[model samples]
Structure formats: structure tokens, C-alpha cells
Target chain A: MAVLQAILDGLMIGGVYAVISIGLTLVFGVMGIVNFAQAEFLMLGMFVAYYAWAWLGLDPLLAAPLAFGVVFLLGAAIQRVLIRRVLKAPEVAQIFLTVGMLIVLENAALLMFGSGFKSVSTPYQTSSLQLGPLFISVPYLAAFAMSVASGLALFLFMRASWFGRAMRATAQDPMAAKLMGIDSDRMHMLAFALGVGLTAFGGAVILPYLTVSPTVGAQFVVLMFTVVVLGGLGSVAGAVVGGLAVGIIQSLSALAFPIQLQNLVLFLVFIAVLALRPKGLLGGAR
Target chain B: MNRSTLLRGLGLAVLLAVAVATPFLLDPRGYAIRVVCLALLFAAMAQCWNIVAGLANQVSLGHAAFFGIGAYTSTLLLIHFGLSPWLGMLVGAVLGGIAAFLISLPTMRLKGHYFALATLAFGEVMRVIANSWSGLTGGPVGISVPFAPPSFAMMQFKETRPYYWLMLAALVVVTLVFVAIRRSKLGYRLRAIKENADAAEVIGVDTTRTKITAAVISGMLTACLGTLYAQFQFFFDPDTVFGVASISVRMAMIAIVGGIGTAAGPILGAFFVIPLEEFANDLFSSRAAGLSQLVFGVLLIGVILIEPRGFMALGSRIRRLFGKGGRP
Candidate 1:
């Protein structure tokens, strides 16, 4: 029963990881660039959610769209002004630039918000629902629900929408997308904005449950990277499955070993997963 | 061998003379010695990083893990048993090298961000272990050497000048190794791999072996520096030993600023970055505690954007200025 409960809890937390990892993966998929600054988008999103709760007394869920909107514009602007200029440069320049952006965003947050860890005070934080020998907090359930719904909506959009097809075409071959009369540049910008929007939304959703701090985004960078790599670098579905697996392993490892040693377990598992399935479970041969 | 080479040798001799005279020229206080020692240590760390990152094209964001491993190993051995740190430091280096080897075995397969992420995870894991492994590491509070130990066997120096000279020697040794490596066939393979791994592989270059060799050498040197750093500081906390800021970003930044692939790049980078950091630290503390890091952060961004080629590139520019009769 305890094991089952741990697994359930792990799955929900994994759902949050999935949401975050998918956002990062999408950007990489479309742009052939990894934004080391993706975590800052999440950080900015958390701040948006926090301010919305404090000033407007709005629920965190409803504030996610607001957070997404702001971050989307930021992402689009970055794509237009900074990333687009260096789109043809060596990938390392992009990596360094993104790292630079990460520094800017993180320090900007520190300057603006200070180092205090703030919590988004919500009524549902304390509430939990019992299911057979297991218990689930309302916030965790809500987070899981939000993640699943978002994932489904994103999946459906990609499958059916023309914008989504253009993104896919661009991901596969930008030149081809251009040949097909799609504005590849616009598609790239939109993809980046959409990706940042997802990360920000994930941040807003998770803010009620987690602490919001200037350095909070750093905590997710490793786990999110692990998820993205394990799911296949650019595969959306892979990220979702990988995230859940990693989450369960991490939570269950706590039960098996000291909490401090739990990360070691995750690291070991990460190595094993990489060695066994380099392309990830859902990804084609990389 | 040539006019430029003769001039380079003369310049090195002059620099060596200045380094030898610096302790006497400056105050003989421990704090000054500490700063100088730390600068040399950072130079060594940056040089090691430049091997894999600069030459082998593997951006390891986890050099601190090796540094911490060295610090923990030497300190733990000395504190737990009556082991001499001189011998223990070598053991520490080996252990750090082995850890790097283990980490690289799988992670080397990962390209770009995945490779960096794997190393990052390794760094965090090492830090957590250092923090919680109370029996070995003394937990977070950390282990310290006894003050004024009876023998040189304990590796305790009576005066700051000795440590300064020792660190200077280490720096010389590190520079020699970097110069040697850059001239070797391994260095050529590294350059080729950095340019294009697939092409290097097709050309029959053992890309994996070259990368692993670079990583191992880099890890060992960094660990050796870590051991010296622990001895000099007289304390080894997990935060200080395994600090991502200290080990990863600092060394990488120096290497980046100095010249990523050049033999003299990281040394030049360390020279500028350390002094600049000290200046910023001195300036910002009274005004704002967090502002120094903010300034450092901004400077880092600006440098990457404006001058990714770094100081070594600028050194030539300076030389050209003199060559063009523009005033030294």
C-alpha cells in the first residue's frame, strides 16, 4: 500500500516535470538550440503567479494564462532581437548567449524580488483527498490535472492545427517549410514563444505547491534536462513518459534510502537509462 | 628558436623573477598569501578545464565535483587516520580522476546539453554526499587540520611565503603540462574532435580515447589544485569545496575569457578575472552585499556577447599595437 501510494504521488509530480520538460524540448526541437535560460522563464512565471495572488487575489490556476502571456512576449522578443540574429552562428554561441540570458533573468529577479522564498497562499494548499489507502493533496491533484490537460491540448493542436504542422515542418527542415510558403522565421519565433508559454504556465501551476525564489528555477534545470534527454531531446511524448518515470524513481528512492542519497539514485538511473536507450523510449534513433 | 620565441622566453624569465620577488615586494601577511595562492589555484583549475572544454570540445559544467573529491579525500584521510596529506593528495587526484572516468564513460556519449547536464548532476550528487556523509566528511561543518602541527609530514607550512612559492611552483608545472599537451598528437586529435567528431572518427582518430584522456588529465590536475586549496584555507566545507560558482563557472569563465583552446588563454583569463572579482568584491560589500555577484554576472554576459574569443585574442592585439609603433 505504501509503495502504491508512493507511485501515485510520484506520477503526479512527474506530470509537472513532463509539462516543464516538454516546453524545453519543444524549443530545442524547433530551433536546434537549447535555451539554458528556459529555467528563468519558469522563474518569471512563478513571480507572475505570486503577484497575481497577492494583488488581485486570483487563484493560481487562473493566473497561469497571464503568466504565459507575459513570458510568451518575452520569448518572442528574445527570438526576434537576439536569437534570430545568431540563428546561423555556431551552436555554442547560442548556448553561451542563452546562459547569458539566464544570468540576466536570474539577477534581474534577484534585484526585483530579493532572495526571500515566497509561497503563493492558496486555500487548497492544505486540502487533500483520500483514495483507498492513499492520500493526494488538492494542489498536487490540480497540478497533475492542469499538466495532463495542457499536454492533451498541446498534442491535439500539434496533430490537427496548420500552425502546428508548420512547426513540425520547420523542425524537420526549415528550408522545406520555407519552400512550402510557410514563414519559417515566424514559425520559429512562435515555437519559442509557445515553448516559453508552457514553461511559464507550468511555473504558475506549481507555484502554489512550491516555494518561489530567485534560484528556484535552478532546482528544476537538472531534473528537466534529465527528463528531456531520457524522453529523446525533441520528442514531446518521450518527455511525458520520461518525466513520470523519473518522478516515481525519485520519490520511491526516498523510501528506500536517506533523502540526501535520493539524488544519487536518480543520477545512477539517469546513466542507466542513457546507456540502455540513448534515443529515449519514445524517440527514434537520435 | 625564432625572434618571437626568444622574446617569449625573455618575457617568461622576467615574469618568473617578478613571481619569485612578489612575496617580499608585498606584505608577508597570510591573507595576501591566501589571495595569491587562490589566484594560482584558479589558474591551474582553468588550465585543466581548457583541455576538455577548449581542446576536446566537451563543456563540463561539473569541474567542482573533482575539486571536492580531492578536498574530501585528502582531508578525510588526514582527519580519520594519521595519513600524510602529501601522499593523500596524490590519492585524492587519482580518486578524482577515477570519478571523472566513470562519469565520462556514459556521459561522453551524450552530445552538447545532455553531456553538460550529466556532469551537472554529478556535481550536485558529490556535493550532497559531502554534506551528508558525516562519518567521512564531518557533514557540513567540515574537518580542519590541527594548528601548528609538529612535522612537515602533516604538510603544514609555518609561513605564508612558503605556500605562495609552492602555489607558484604548481602554476609553473600546470603551465608546462598545458604547453606540452597542446604540442602533442593527442592535442591534434582533440582539435580535430572539437572541430567535428564524426570527421575525426572517419580519419581514424580515436575520439573517445582522446576525450577520456583529456577529461582524466583535467580532473586529476583540478583535484591536485583542490588539495592545495584545502590545505591553504585550513577548512573544507562542502559549499566551498563543491561550490558550482567556484569550480564550474569560475574556471570556465576564466578559460572562456582567456582563450578557450589556447595554451595561455586560461592563465590570462585567471589573471584578469581574479583581480577583477577581488575589486568588485571590495567595492560592493559596503554598498550592497549581492551587488558584486550581479556585476560579475553582467560582466560575464557582456564578455560572452562581445568577446567570446577572450583575452588571449586581445594579447595579440596589444602586441600588434606595439608592433605598429603605437606605444606600449
Candidate 2:
């Protein structure tokens, strides 16, 4: 019964992790560049939700799209000013710039927010739905539902839209896309914006449960990176599967072993998976 | 070749003499000695990182893991078993090297960011263990070393000067090894792999063996530095050991700014950036220290934007601008 409870809880929380990582994987797939600042987009969303709740009495769910819109523009500007400059440079330069951007955004938040922890509160703080002996908290249920809906929307976008096809073509072959009269540059911008939008949306979805602070992004980004790598670098489906697997393993392992060893399990799993299958579960074999 | 090499050696000797003597001459006080100790520590670490990151072209963000491993291992051994730090440092180095080797075996297959993330997870795992393993690591409060007069056995120096000299010794030995490796057959293969892994492997470079060798050596050196750091500060904690800021501040600013691959770059980087960082801290109030980090971050961005190759490349450019003249 305890194991089952842990599994249910893990799956609910893992939904958020999957949403966060899907954004990361999508950006990497479309742009072949990992945006280390992905977490800052999440941070921006949480802040938007917090302020909207505090000042205007707006619900967090309603504020999420607003956060997504603002962050999308921010992401587009980042692409224009910084990433575009390095689009043709060597891989190392691209990595350094993105890492630098990560540092800059993290510090900027620290300076702007003053390192205080903030959170959004709603009416369903302690509400839960009980299924026999099993229970699901309201925040977790809402987060899971939003994640599932967004995942489906993302899948549809990829499978059913002209812009999505253009993005895919750019990912598959930029030169070929250009030859076919698609503006690969515009596609890259859209893809980056879309990824940032996902992170923003994720932030708003999970804000009620987790506290927001400048450094919170780092903690979550580390987990998201683990998920992305575990899933395969640029596979969205892999992220969804890997995120839940990691979430279950992490939560359940705490029950079976020392709580201190929870992270050890994750690290060990990462090593094991890398050793056995370098390209994650859904990743293309390299 | 001999003449230029001789001149280079003389110049380097002069620079070392100045660094060694600065504490006594200017009496910039023990604060300067403290800075030198830190700079030496970072130089040693950056060199260790360079073996794999620079030479082998595999970036590991968690060299701090080895540093932490060495620190915690030696600190725990000394605190619990009353082992001498001389022996402790040796044990620490071995432990750190082994940990790194084991980690790399599984993670090295993943390219680029995946490998980087794996190392990061390894580091976080170490930290979490250190914090939760109450009996061994003392949990969040950390362990403090007993102070004593300068002694060979304890590796505990009474004064800052002795610590400076100790770090200098480590620095010299590490630098010599670094230079020796750079000129070795293995070094050539590492360069080949760094430049192009497939080409190197096709030409029979044995890239995996070379990367592993670099990692072990790098880990050992970093661990040695960690032992020294604990001795200098007289304390060891999981935060100091495994802190991302601690490693990133040193490696990212110094190594990245100095020149990622050059022998002289990290030293120049330590010299320039560490002092500026200290000054930035001194000039600001505690509450406003974030501004210093902001400035530092901006400086890093500016440097990256203007000169991605860093200070060494700039130095070469300046030399070329001087019409290849001998030193004025």
C-alpha cells in the first residue's frame, strides 16, 4: 500500500518534471543548442504568477498564459541578440554563451528579487481527492492535468501544423529547408520561443506547491537536465517517459533506502542507463 | 629552440620568485598570503581540469567532486582515526582518483552535455551524502581541524606563510607534471582527440584510455588541492566541498578567462580575476554583494562576446601588434 501510494505521488509530481524537460528537449531538437537559461524562463513564470496573485488578485492558472507570452518574447530577443551571433560558430562557443546566459539570468534574478522566497496561494491548499486508501493532492492533480493537456497540445502542434512542419524540417536539415524556401532562421526563433513558453507554462502550473526564489531554478534545472539526458538529448517522448521513471525511482527509493541515498539512486541510474544504452529509451541510436 | 626555451624558463623563474617573495616584501599582510593560497589552489585545479577539459576536449563541470571527495576523506580519516595529514592527503588523492575513474567509466559514453550532467549528479550525490551522513561528516555543521604549531606530520602550519609555501610547492610540482604531460606522446593523442575524436580514433589514438588517464591524474591533483584547502581554512564542510559556486567561480572565471587550454592561462586568470573579485567584495556592503556578482557576470559576458579565446589569445595578439620585437 505504501509503495503504491509512493508511485501515485511520484507520477503526479513527475508530470511537472516531464513538462519542464519536454521544453528543453524540444529546443535542443529544433535548434541543436541547449538553452541553459531554460530554468530562468520557469522562474519568470513563477514570478508572474506571484505578482499577479499578490497585486491584482488573479489566479495562477490564468496568469500562466501571460507569463508564457512575455517569456516567449524574451526568448525570441535572446535568439536575436545572442544566439544568432553564435549560430554558425563552433559548438564550444555556443555552449559557453548559453552557460554564460544561464549565469547572467540567475544573477539578474538574484539582484532583482533580493533572494526572498515567495509563493502563490489558492483556495485548494489542503484539498485532495481520495480513491479508497489512495489520495491525490489538489495541486498535484491540477499540475498533472495541465501537463498532460500541454503534452497533447505539443504533440498535435508537431503533427498537425505548417509551422510545426517547418520547425521539424529545420531540425532535420536546415540547408534542405532553406532550399525548399522555408525561412530556417524564423523557424529557429519560433522553436526557441515555443520551448520558453513551455517552461513558463510549467512554472505557473507548479507554483502553488513549490516556493519561488532565485536559486530554485538551479535545483529544478539540475533535475531537468538529468531527465533530458536520461530520456535522450532531443526526444520529447523520451523526456515524458524518463521524467516519470526518475520521479518514481527517486520517491520510492527514499522508502526502501536511506533518504540521503535518493540522489545516489538517480546518479547510479544515470550511469547505468548511459553505459547500457547511450542513446536513451526513445532517442535515436547514435 | 633552446634559446627561446631558456629565455622562457628565466622569465617564469623571475615571475615565481616575485610571487613567492611578495608576502614578505610588500607586507600586503596575511590577506595577500591568503589570496596567494587561493590563487595557487585555483591554478592547480584549472590545470587538473585542463588535462581533460583542455587536452581531451571533454568538459566536466564537477571537478569539485574530486575536491570534495579528497577533502571529506582526509578530514574524516584525520578526525576519526587520528591519521597524519601527510598520509591523509595521499589517501585523499587515491580515493578521489578512484571515484573519478569509476564515474567516468559509465558516463563517458555520453557526449558533451550528457557527460557534464552525469558529473554534476555525481557531485550533488556526494554533497547530499556528506550532509546526511551525520556520524561521518558531522552533517551541516561541518568538521574543524585541531590547530597546532607548524609541523611536518600534521601538515598544519602555524602561519599563513607556511601555508603559502606549501601551496607553492604543490603548484610547482603540478605545473611540472602538466608541462611534462603536454610534451608526451599521450598529450599529442589528447590534442588529436580534442581537435577531432573520429579522426584520432581512426588513426589509432586510443582515445578512451587517454581520457581516463587524464581524468585520474586530474582528479588526484584536484584532491590534493582540496586537502590543502581544508588545512588552510582549518575546516571542511559539505557546502565548501561540493558547492557549485565554489568550483564555478574559480573554474569558469579563471580557466575560461585565462585561456582554456594554455599552461600560463589559469595563472594569469587567477592573478587578474581573483583580486578583482576580492576587491569587488571589499568595496560593497554584505547586502549589496549581489552587485559584485552582477558586475562579474557582466564582465564575463563582455569577455566572451569580445574575445572567446580569452586572455592568452589576447596576449598573443598584443605581442603580434608589437611587430615581433624582443621585450622592450
The model with the greatest lDDT is 1
Note the DockQ of each predicted structure. 0.43, 0.53
Badly placed stretches (over 4 Å) of model 2 are A258-260, A284-286, B321-328
The most accurate candidate by DockQ is 2
Q: List the residue pairs that clash in candidate 1.
A: none
My TM-score estimates for the predictions, one after another, are 0.93, 0.95
Q: Which lDDT values do the candidates have, in the order given?
A: 0.83, 0.80
lDDT of 1 by residue, A140-244 (tens): 899899989888989998889999998999999988889999998999999899998899999999987898999888777767877887888889988998889
- Give lDDT for model 2: 0.80
Assess chain B of each prediction and give its TM-score: 0.93, 0.93
Model 2, B165-245: lDDT tens per residue?
Answer: 888888788878788889999889889988888898899988788888888998998898888888888887887888765
